[model samples]
Target: MAPSYLSIALIVLGEAFASQLPLFETSSLSQTHLTAKELISSKSLQDRIHVDNLLERANTLYSIAQLGEDEYNHPTRVIGSKGHLGTIDYIYSTIAQLGDYYTLSNQSFPAVVGNVFESRLVLGSEVPQSAIAMSLTPPTKKKQPVFGPLALVSNFGCDASDYLDLTSKIALISRGDCPFGTKSSLAGRAGAIAAVIYNNEKGALGGTLGTPSPDHIATFSISDSDAALYIKKLKDGEEVQASAYIDAIVESIETTNIIAQTKEGDPENCVMLGGHSDSVTEGPGINDDGSGSLTLLEVATQLVNYRVNNCVRFAWWAGEEEGLLGSDYYVSVLSPEENLKIRLFMDYDMLASPNFAYQVYNATNSLNPVGSEELRDLYTEFYTSKGLNFTYIPFDGRSDYDAFIKHGIPGGGIATGAEGVKTEKERQVFGGVAGDWYDPCYHQLCDDVGNVNLTAWELNTKLVAHSVATYARSFDGYPKRTGIEATAVLDVPLSKYHGPKLQV
Candidate 1:
């Protein structure tokens, strides 16, 4: 027989009490304060926010690894070996602090095969120099490589035909039509032992391994400037090889993923909220998502107090900086039933920084629904309701949500911005100065806490919470934002969701 509503309520209640109750140093509630007319006459709602103590605790918790000062994107100095591990560790700690309101787990995957490196290339000659190798890459076995120096040969903007004869040779090229994995596969197919990629442009490279290849080979990247120096030397016909090694054997070290939850009730109805906690070895990533990570923790902490229906989850993913490795692994492992149970995926990635504008990807191909006009309207409505202003954009269904979208989940999310400086047109839209970075710190060391615009940061977090709660409250059977109409929603066409195309 189906479990009775009372039975489910009892179980959820037990779980809620299972953890230490939220201390609610401040009453954990929504932005609406009833004292409105009386208080609004003088005070600001922002003033009522309990920032100091929360910031202290959050900083105390988030400060692990003294990450603010760390060079790696997501180091787990206090938890696991890599930055992703640190993310899982934090989720676990938060779960414990929140009294097991949720349980955190990890999903491990191997992408870049063959020899791995321990110390992430902090900045190979330049901040954007090191191309992110797939996790499947094995660790370099020796201090020095059998091959003395590697060559910097252009793949001709990722066209493999350029370097046809590279057997036993390592080639450095740039990104183009081919996926990184595809290029690597082609290089492998060409008998080339390995390949490295260099950027043609100045910004950070955001694409992941384009296609998945199982070749056990050494593959990575060096910046365009760094590659140029090598290229010049090679043009002069000088040997340009370098040794490579990493102790990446599974036995060498362990990896983990931490998760938390609002309350999993009935086990059938559940909602999820998550982000990759693990950072790259590139930069500190306070903005790449340290801000989002902090936001997730704060929202989870705030939501834990209010009683609700359905299971709501908070997951801090690892290895996201490593091409969404952790979250991908997590999604790949879910039972078909579990995957279906996740009605929505509200992903919070790099939202706090004023550097970038905001975008929401509504993926329909995967488990999630496609980007709909209604979803956009919901965001605008939520923002306006909270007295914040925002422009609704389309969905670019990338990121870990791909895992869910693939499983048929209705995925929608918020991102403050990435690279691509805000244009005058966008300035007219979002009201920021033109020529400013959409997310200047993107993958750089400058992605510190200071980069976050406090107002925007706080608003972004609140907006996410509002969206999640609205969905949960209205989730009688279907995933819908409360009081929102289908017609009112803005649908970012699939083409635009991935951003614009170049004009000839």
Candidate 2:
């Protein structure tokens, strides 16, 4: 059972402690006399989350994706695709059927969707090697293939000198030191027709150029082994001829963000939780965010059985894969009065990576909002109480929480893992392979229903439920809302921070 306190003491002590702790505060004590609902405990809500039921729902979503697979030529729920539209309809219809318990609405916005039809590299008549085109790169308009002599760029291709006179040629560059966009821009400035960036490590390179750039020529990624072979041949005084072909589509499309808010709770102090509803072009993204999306749906359904003091809003964000587009748009459109009503925002993305670790966002370090530390501590306490080990992920804006924190809303959340390789120490603690990706099939076609770690998914969902239930009852230890005008963080471009480019 959770601890309890007297109403006056809770509020008075909260104010007294607010000076010492930036993330601590409480609502007015006068409002304590408001009629309280017959609420269920967090443990009761956690116990109500059945793993079998969760899996069954997840499988149904996968089936929906299967039905919509023909449109995209792959099983994906990417925004503006049939699969994602179906996903939105399903979520909206399901919550709408819950009677008058919640108020639901679909917030529509325009998003630039990028589709790579086919990308290839042919090296001197050898079999065409598989390559992934950088997202948002303009498709080649020329009918003839771009054929030119390949020249190696010096020092990761980030400097002007690295790209000398190389008219009508292709640049072969190593990936490091800067964003893939910066390197491609340099290649364009050097008069190169295209650019191919090879991985610095021992694997196939797959990444985004961050955003659309007119200066960015056609760019593709290749395996480190292939790059090494090309370098060796060049070192041996052999001229290597390369041909690059890319078929892609980049266009603006309309998408929706599903927002549902409880009707019975205090509307002024709302608790918001979200996860991206869209997937990559490769696969169904069942585990990538289908896990988080469904977990929220399941919890929201069960929460209808109880009541709360503060409103609970569930947001299924779209356009996260194209650089946090949907969530950013949602925050950008909020008026100052509307923004103040949101007390805090919690995000959940990739909650069930196969090589899982219980990771809470480390709000104590970077990008800490007023009440972020308290949110982090709450999650930490929840896992510790369950006799489970946990770790902290840096609070870099890599998920839906990015825009919320940037807008001064206290934020925190959990992730099982993404494409990051697990260390030996992490393996010992989490009981998974040391040198393998957290989600081996991340952003790939195999990230279907079977890719999730059921144990991790179930446990993380329970923690989410716990957080929701605790905050719904009262904002005893949360920061008081201040109607300060929020400055747009999007005005300044997001830096070239690299990691697993899963969601955001």
Candidate 3:
């Protein structure tokens, strides 16, 4: 006969407690000791949050990013970089202060990370236009720049026939027909030494090649106006000689994900909240994710003062900008039984876009688990209670929640915005510039501490505290997971949602 609910609960509890490693850092437990045993509530936790604390933390992250500026020539917390490693240390040390209240462990995994030292595009010896190196592009040999005559590819460089006899020439391609990876591959195959992909829309382009390929040459993304100038020159039979310098390298490195859980809660049922700790290659990422990660950190810090009947796992994921590498690796390792113990998962990413909108993930996707809608309702109710207007964003799987949702784990989260433009309707509701991107500095050099909107970030942080405290105290109203096989819930289409990676 199959095991009863009590037996399964007992088994999960025993295994969870047995497998949990002890808190590794023991030095400063006396300094930030936990004493309160009162039940966690929205008021109790939200009252502890302060905007000053968030600002101080964001400033600290900026300083850490600045420490690695000598290597990248920019302050960035990209994975495998000095800034990101420093960030990992910061999170670990911060959580370690509450040594007796939580069990902390670092999950180390091998990841292929890309680094771009320089991305330069100069037309006819004029000043270099603003350009960013596409991630995963192979570095030029011995730091040598590739100089060649610019040749425009017919169509969007999606096919081989679109190229002319381009041996030792650079291919100038438009960005509409296909993925950046396809264009780069075709350009290299056509004997082009380098390639430039211009955006189809406004603003500077910051992109990735999805994955590294031997056929991908030194590819860079430029704005549409720059592409237009070159196209006009080429159309007039002008010899637009181009010089491309892309210093980039892809290498395998070990990255760490910091996992911390309350030691006093029931281990069988857990409420997991996560945010990516690494940033893109362009900037300090203070707003893009520093806001979200620091929010979780701040909440976790304050949470130690209260008691929880259900487990609360706070995760600082690594390699998120590289397509949710850390979270994906995490879920892939969980056994079916282990997957069920995680009652629900909530992801927080980019909570403070400069021109922000209160977005709640509408878990209306048919593939989302039974309790996903309930999770959405929880966030909506919080916003409603505060008389705040919020818009519903689809469960597009753009962040760390993609991995959890794939395994039928009930999930939902909040995002201020990313590269998407703010609609006029959104402006009327949230009152920001409609024509501009929600976060113009997203994935660019301008995404530093100044990019964060303190007002929006603080509000969202309170919501995070509210949701975490609610679930931590009890999953009473939340749907209980039936002891169904994990495979049964794995029917969600993985291809439907794009995690962090932009197809363009």
RMSD (Å) of each candidate, 1 decimal:
10.1, 10.8, 8.8
The count of backbone overlaps in candidate 3 is 0
Predicted candidate 3 versus true structure: per-residue lDDT over 1-504, tens digit per residue: 112212322232223222332337665444224434668898989999999999988988887787568778889898877787767767776787666678888898878788776667777776446566777787655668888899988887788888888889988888876778888888898899888888778867766777678888888888887778888999899999888887777888878899999877889999999999999877999997999999999999999878788889999999999878999999999888888989999999999999999998888535577788888899999999999999988677678988887787888899899888999999999998999999999988999989999999999999999989988888887888874333212232344234676546
**What is the lDDT of every predicted structure here?**
0.52, 0.78, 0.81
TM-scores for the candidates: 0.66, 0.84, 0.82
Report clash pairs, candidate 2.
none
Model 1 TM-score, all chains together:
0.66
Stretches > 4 Å off in candidate 3: 1-36, 122-131, 148-166, 172-178, 198-205, 223-243, 365-367, 423-425, 432-434, 444-446, 482-501
lDDT of 2: 0.78
- Which model is ahead, 2 or 3, in terms of TM-score? 2
C-alpha lDDT of candidate 3 relative to the true structure: 0.81
Q: Which ten contiguous residues of candidate 3 have the minimum total lDDT?
A: 1-10
Instruction: For residues 90-158, write the lDDT of model 1, one tens digit per residue.
Output: 445454555534544434445321223352332223333354554445333342342434555554535
What clash count does candidate 2 reach? 0
Quality of model 1 by C-alpha lDDT: 0.52
